[model samples]
Target: MGKNRLQLENHLFILPDYLNHPFISGNKLRKLKYNVLEAKKQKKETLLTFGGAYSNHIAAVAYAGKEYGFKTVGVIRGEELADSISQNPTLTFAQNCGMEFKFVSREQYRNKNNPLFLNQLKEAFHNIYVLPEGGTNALAVKGCEEILEEADAKFDYICCPVGTGGTISGLINSSFKHQKIIGFPALKGDFLNKEITKFAAKTNWELNLDYHFGGYAKVTDALIAFINTFKLQYNIPLDPIYTGKMMFGICDMIQKGYFDENAKILAVHTGGLQGIAGMNTVLKQQNKPLIV
Candidate 1:
């Protein structure tokens, strides 16, 4: 599993996790590993989850559910996206993987966990195995706990992109006492402070909120330039949503002496590469340089 990996500037990096499998590569694979098994354990035949137009979670759940022989339902966040699924790359990919959709307005989507909303889904898809959006549940965190290994204990810091807090929380739980887990969140706000810790068991972790780059899916010219330059230098394509921002934060922190000069760092590339195509389309419309 240590494939497409490299070391740079005293830091070790690995491929987009989405590359591990044609379908479930990246963090999605790790997040779903135990959930898939639990679903099978219950003999569940349908997987229900939620996400937006370009959610890696949606695509991953679709592919994993299809491959593992479970029916997939993606309750997409934006109701407007339903009519234009063919134009949306992520949704198109999930649809191709046989994922059914239930488009909900942003307001309704926000209430995804409301007992009433969940009851509606339960009624629609009986005995379905429900996965929280971003696929971060206890079992998913269990899967992420395995992302680190015995050999990884040597690093002084373990960095990862945080979306729904599951991945970083898993790292927090499995991290060694000497290794601090630094999460570069893709979204603004301290909301994640509570969400991530709920599943974490360690105190050796922190969230660098300065690198969100104007909130989720929001990017600037400077960010695009960094992404382009990084890809050219490292020969690694990073999605703008998660890994790109995390890498930018790490480099900024490194330059600012945030880490010890000899600190060894490991960054998990969670694999939101699929969203690049969609992001590029938007960039082109905005007359911006594309992520190369």
Candidate 2:
């Protein structure tokens, strides 16, 4: 089958078909494929994972669990929910997908690898499979390998937003000999480069971490306006948490003459469209218009 078309300013090209699956879409779907298969190999009946209130990983795990007939448990990193309470949109979506939720204190949650924690969870739910936050595991890396294979042509530069660094790491690992991979981090922190280096060291490719803009989950008015303008011009949706920052960084670098005109850049649009819901609150709090 041919690649899907996405019209962008000054050019039109085929975009990867990441929306074919209802629950399994975008980068999350790409990362979860092998994780699910590995779970099956281990004969695990339940899939347990960790994430914040609006984590895409949590939503994907919930959807995958229900789709594959496995029980799912989400260990939330925050305060406990009261009975008969209304949930946030993300949590509501997960509940509708038949995933169980468990709230835990931030301190206790940090001990995710402690035997006592695993044992307690095992006793509560037998035959469980534990997936790391954002599904950043070796199995997820294997699944991400499929992304590089899906690219229609070789590119000089491959760009993607870095969150936990799993997706970008996978892209770097799967890069062709001549391709250079760069990760635009969405979070601000000194440790991101270190993390990327650690992951990249395991692979044959190196990662460039200079395009984070600000930091992870950190959005400025300029970034928001840029995202709005791009949507108006391209009519393609981008979540501020990742893809938006990636596009912003790419455009900035291009204008600054970082890329040669002959260089072909491939930007991975890792979908997290559900994150749009949170933008309403941010805009209202900032007294900004909802529309571009």
lDDT of 1 at 274: 86
lDDT of each: 0.88, 0.74
Cα lDDT of model 1 by residue, 1-292, tens digit: 2444467765555535556776687889999999999999999989999998889899989999878899999999887887888889999999999999999898888998898899999999898999999999899999999888787767788899999999999989998888899999899899999998799988899999899988999998889899899989988888899999988988898889888888888888888888898899888989988988
TM-score of each: 0.96, 0.88
Q: Candidate 1 deviates by what RMSD?
A: 1.7
Error of 2 at 37 (Å): 1.2
Best by TM-score: 1
What's the distance in Å from true for residue 185, model 1? 0.6
lDDT tens readout by residue for model 2, 1-292:
1255343533223244357566667788877888888889999999998887778888888999989989999988876642321546677788888889888889988988788998898899889999888888777766776676545354677777778878877787777777777777777665666666655644444444555556556667787788889889877777778888888878888788887777777777878877667565556778875534
